[model samples]
Target: MNILFVADPLEQFKIYKDTTFSMMREAQRRGHEISACEPRDLGWQTGQPVTGQVRDIRLTGNADVWFTETPRRLAPLHGFDAVVMRKDPPFDAEYIYATHLLGQAEREGAAVVNRPASLREHPEKLAVMEFQQFTAPTLVTRDPAAVRAFHAEHRDIILKPLDGMGGMGIFRVREDGLNLGSITETLNKDGAETIMVQRFVPEIAAGDKRILIIAGEPVPFVLARIPQGSEVRGNLAAGGKGVAQPLSPRNREIAEAVGSALAPRGLLLIGLDVIGDYVTEINVTSPTCFQEITEQTGFDVPAMFVDALEAEVARGN
Candidate 1:
């Protein structure tokens, strides 16, 4: 089987902890051919199949440089057995356009990991709104008065932009409500942008747990990113300390419910972000944590992912 990864530039990857790299390694172990391309490498013409300028990559065991790409050439996406969309987010206009191209490739009979329509339909932050049973008290609004009202009701609240990743632009307005107005202004952009406001879950002191689910099943272990020092964010990108641990019963319950609900939506891989018992986000675009959990708990998260992908590919065929 040949697998084409549509992700960020190969040069920018941190192989030691990168989940996509882990997937590639496991795929190679199974004797599958691996290919690489960025979203920009994809294009479509009237007469051509939705195509990408891709390179066949052979992995060497070198730590600093793990992969060597063969000469790049144009290939239709449908030529590959599976196409993995591993691009990181701020799912802006360009990302949406890239999905449009990938959607075209799907029409050409390629097995794209995340069904492109679901990706467009399920924005991570907004995805939680539908599953209120497992989520924290949350609000989506652009009006300052509404945010102020939510803040007044829940005193300690979190305010964040709709499109931010890695904890950027997230503000915690304490009971005192200091600078609440200003925080709302910055996040909502004075009524022009919509922002999410949720009652702050104090269990954040425990950790922001990332539970990886494959094909609607939960992995037994998770990467709990505990905030360090005075940091309010528990994202690994925001300097949170990652601790791999077995999922609690509550964790599994939430995973079973949420993961099953999303699997048929064309979301093969998902990361459910749990701050305490409440789910904070549902990540479908690029749900990570394979390396962090596997290296510590020996869970073989990437292998599970590849297993799901392989099954999906076979089913598609």
Candidate 2:
């Protein structure tokens, strides 16, 4: 199998922490050839497909790095059995354009996991609102009056950008919190983006659970992300600790509902965040809970993911 990853520059990734690197490593171990290129590498040549520089990728264990040489341009989007869209996000305009290009590749018969159309339609936070019955109170608005009303109603609310990822700009506004004005001003400047105001789930003090779903089935393990002292965000990138945790009945129910809803849409991978019994977020773009879950539970998530990808590729062929 020849696999191509549409992702960030290789130098920016910490080998162990990056799910793309982990998947690439596992794919290589399974005897699949791998290469990678950024979204800018994709373009059409006179209505004919053409791609910018692509380099062969190699990963070694102890060194925690990838080795690549000068890139060579090639025909766009053919010859690869699978293309993994693993770009990290703020999900800006560039990301959407990349999805459009990838969707074209999918039409050409490549097994693009999570389906490009589905990825474009689903922004991580907004997509989960479709399952509001299973989630905490959430409000998407930019009006200061509306946000203030929500804050007054909930008393404890979390404010975050609607399209942000990796827990960026996530804020918890407590009853006595004083910075709402500044926060709102910053988030709303330039008429840039709307913020998500959610009723803060207090169960977060215990931990935030991240459940990984592959091929529409929930992996057996969950990561309980406990925030550091005085921290309100429970994201690993935000100084939270990930401990292996088992799913409770409620967690399983939420996962089952979300899985059943998404599987038919060709979203082969997802990571769902549950704080207490309330589902907080549904991560679709390059979700990553696999490493923490595997490290704690001894589950072979990489192998399972590879198996699912292989199966999808087989079906495409």
Candidate 3:
């Protein structure tokens, strides 16, 4: 199998814990060929299939320089056995454009995990709304009055930008509402942009759990990212400590329900952010924590992912 990863630059990867690297390693170990290209490398001419300037790469055992690759060459995306989309998000204009290209590649018979159309349909922050039964009292709006009203009712609430990733632009306003107005203005861009606001879930102290669902099945273990010090965000990138644990019953329930619905829509992999019993986010674009869960629990997350990828490609064939 030839697997082409649509991801960020190889130089930007921290091989020790990067999930995309883990996938590449597992695929290579299984004797699958590996290639990589950033979304920017993808191109399509009027008469040509969607293509990329892909670099064929091999993993080196050394940690300092983890991979060796040949020079880039143009290749049609449909030529790969599987094209994995693992680009991190701001989900900006360029990301949307890349998805459009991937969608075209899919039409040309390329096997793309987490289907491009589904990625466009499910914005990480907004996706949770589709499964409101498993979430807290949440609101999405840009009007300051609506935000203030939500704060008045919920007292303790979380405010975050729609496009934030890794805990960026997240704020908590308690009963006193210390910085509610200011935070709202900043997050919503003074009514120019919309944001998500939810009643604060106290169970965050236990951890913000990340449950990985592959091919509509939940991984047995989840990585609980616990906040450090006074931080409210439990994202590992926000200085949180990651601890792997078996999924609680509620966690499994949520994962099963969300997974079943999403998998048929072509999301081969998903990451659900669960705070207590409630899901806080539905991550489709580059859902991670594979290395953390695998290292602590020995569950082999990347292997499960590769198995799913193989199955999908076989079915497509």
After superposing candidate 1 on the true structure, give the runs of residues whose Cα lies further than 4 Å from its correct spot: none
What TM-score fits each model? 0.98, 0.95, 0.99
Q: 145-199 in candidate 3: lDDT tens per residue?
A: 9998998999999999988799999999999999789998888888999999999
Which of 2 and 3 is the better model by TM-score?
Answer: 3
Off by over 4 Å in 2: 50-52, 68-71, 190-192
* Cand. 1 TM to true fold: 0.98
Taking the tens digit of each residue's C-alpha lDDT, what string does model 1 give over 127-204? 998799999899998889998899889999999997888889989999999999988888787789999999999999
Largest lDDT belongs to which candidate? 3
Q: What is the lDDT of candidate 1?
A: 0.93
**Per-residue lDDT for 309 in model 2?**
93
In order of lDDT, best first, we have: 3, 1, 2
Higher-TM-score candidate among 1 and 3? 3
Best by TM-score: 3
How do these models rank on TM-score, best leading? Answer: 3, 1, 2
